[model samples]
Target: MQFLEASREQGIVTVTLSRGKVNALNESVIDEMTACIRDLAVDPAVRAVILTGQGKFFTYGFDIPEFLEYGKEDFLRYLTKFTNFYGALFLYPKPVVAALNGHTMAGGCMIAIACDYRIMVTGKARISLNEINFGSSLFAGSVEIMKMWLGQKNAEIAVYTGALYSAEEALGLGLIHEVAAEEDLVPRARRIAEEFAAKDGAAFGSIKKLLRGPLAERIRERERASLLEFVDIWYSEKTWNLLKEKQIRS
Candidate 1:
């Protein structure tokens, strides 16, 4: 895929985001990722998957500069594509792990939480869903994903406060499963992926479905109706003005 780096070894697939400096998610990036993950889920040779970003960022989140370029119709299409990708990643049958190498913000945080486990790299990097900071709204399914991992209160606080937490803080909040030095991050992730790959594929997938299916279905149902509205708000004058002001300040 143009936006990602995918490699398979010993039944494990590692997919690294490589679109730009920070691996921001856009319509094309989402499409390619969704397709790749769906294929891996069904591939018999693929026992597990690791998702990560290529450089200093796990991902900087959605392509806001691109978002500003979208009109209503275009934004709606983007939102729908993103919603579909989120659903696919959340309910992926094979084991998925996020190797957080650096800063992960907004939509990037959503993708990380969808994985079965998250291993964050230690440093000055942070993770957050700062949508509210820019007057943007979270996708309905994204809210569910956050709640599934952080519980109701922590999820609400994280989204609403638009706070950036250091790796240790994120771990304390249960946003990530483990924290490793930057050099050790990928190896740690690979070790975990191997452990998960050792499980019986069919039974493991089935049990995962049984455990996470309800929430995945809930996200799908909400996105079907709310994505359009999300696009509307994203294109609204209020949000645009807020974005403009933030850009000027920067």
Candidate 2:
């Protein structure tokens, strides 16, 4: 399957991340995603966007093997691109929903949080940001998004505990908007989106902005600063070595 795949039906644009098994976030994935999102964002027919993954896992996080071989410039460039992709998601005019297919971890969970809401499928699959376990941390923008979306304490726990939660646990913690049986996941998510899409689009958009208005400027500023800081830190030899270790361990 392609790195990114999409199908438009009615007022919904469903994007499936199908890079490979246990799909990991990489430059190609980010690039394809940015373009897809850009196209969808402007489509008059697209009233909402639903993101999902294939198989028993949503995403496992970054591709450590690729990162380990990256040099200072390589890492920096990668991050600049990544941050820009995230910036697009953060400020998208329309609501975006993540249908958490399965086993989301580290960068995977972070990406899910970028959406306005998330729906998860039931299973033993775990979800979390385990970057700390890998001697890394969330990008500044990621942290801010989590803080704004999940509250300060919940965000802290997700980043610091490095603990993975079951679908039910994620819902209880407010990490996911709802959970459903595997078969019901997509339909249930669609029902939720349909309700939202049926509302006055302008009013819906306004409410979203109203709620986030206070933090919009701050979030945008952090997004820019994060892009620069990410580039600067990616050059660290320690980071390269850590990536190498993660690759070998995986």
Candidate 3:
């Protein structure tokens, strides 16, 4: 739990991403999160789960500098960890809520959409799926989750434009269920979790499966091919040069 903190109260478990500063998703963080979700999903005492972050960032997204040095195999392995985590979150048999304390972008946005509910704090922070700007392809699992949360048209627009939305704008677009002040974010998420937790787990979990199962299957069916295509494009000379220029400038 080096990168995460888990605490339970009133049958709800809160898992906070505590990575330094930006809370970027790297291999270790993703693996830990996948494990966390799986563990909580089966715990009978846990009625709902609250997923959030520490400090000012929910997450800034993938660790670009770490990804920059990845060879094809390394990158594919990394993508596998990422996509598998998304699938786990999407199919977890318990209610999950995301409390966005700050900026949620790229991979962070993917994680937020996988949750059953999303509550973002109003602030200077923005939310976006900025993969296009990074010259990266979206995983099918992530695309399916985004579409499920935001509808197809909004998902298409968000991915195509890489637009960052304020909390109000995100709510208008259906990216988040509610918005609150920074201090109220987790409290709001916990209250929502309590409301959801009152439902019988078996019934709620079954209905969730019925609603999302097809999309999850589609994502699984396309996983391997999508990963291959993404890795190929990511390692191309043009992308390498683009990343190199960005790195030098940074």
Candidate maximizing lDDT? 3
Write model 1 residue lDDT over 1-250, tens digit each, in one string.
7888999999999999997787888888998998898888778899999999988899888777777777888878877887777677787888999999999988899888888999999988999989888888888888888888899999999999999999999999999999999999999999999999999988888998999999887777787667776666766789888877653110
* Tens-digit lDDT string for candidate 2 (45-120): 8898888988877888888787766776787787777777766676677888888889888778877887888999
Residue pairs with colliding backbones in model 1 are none
TM-scores of the models, in the order given? 0.95, 0.90, 0.95
- Model 2 lDDT, full chain set: 0.78
Question: How would you encode candidate 3's per-residue C-alpha lDDT over 62-105 as one tens digit per residue?
Answer: 87788787778887898899988888888889999999999998
Give the RMSD in angstroms, all C-alphas superposed, for model 1.
2.0
Whose TM-score is higher: candidate 1's or candidate 2's? Answer: 1
Model 2 segments more than 4 A misplaced: 224-241, 248-250
Clashes of 1: 0
TM-score of 3: 0.95
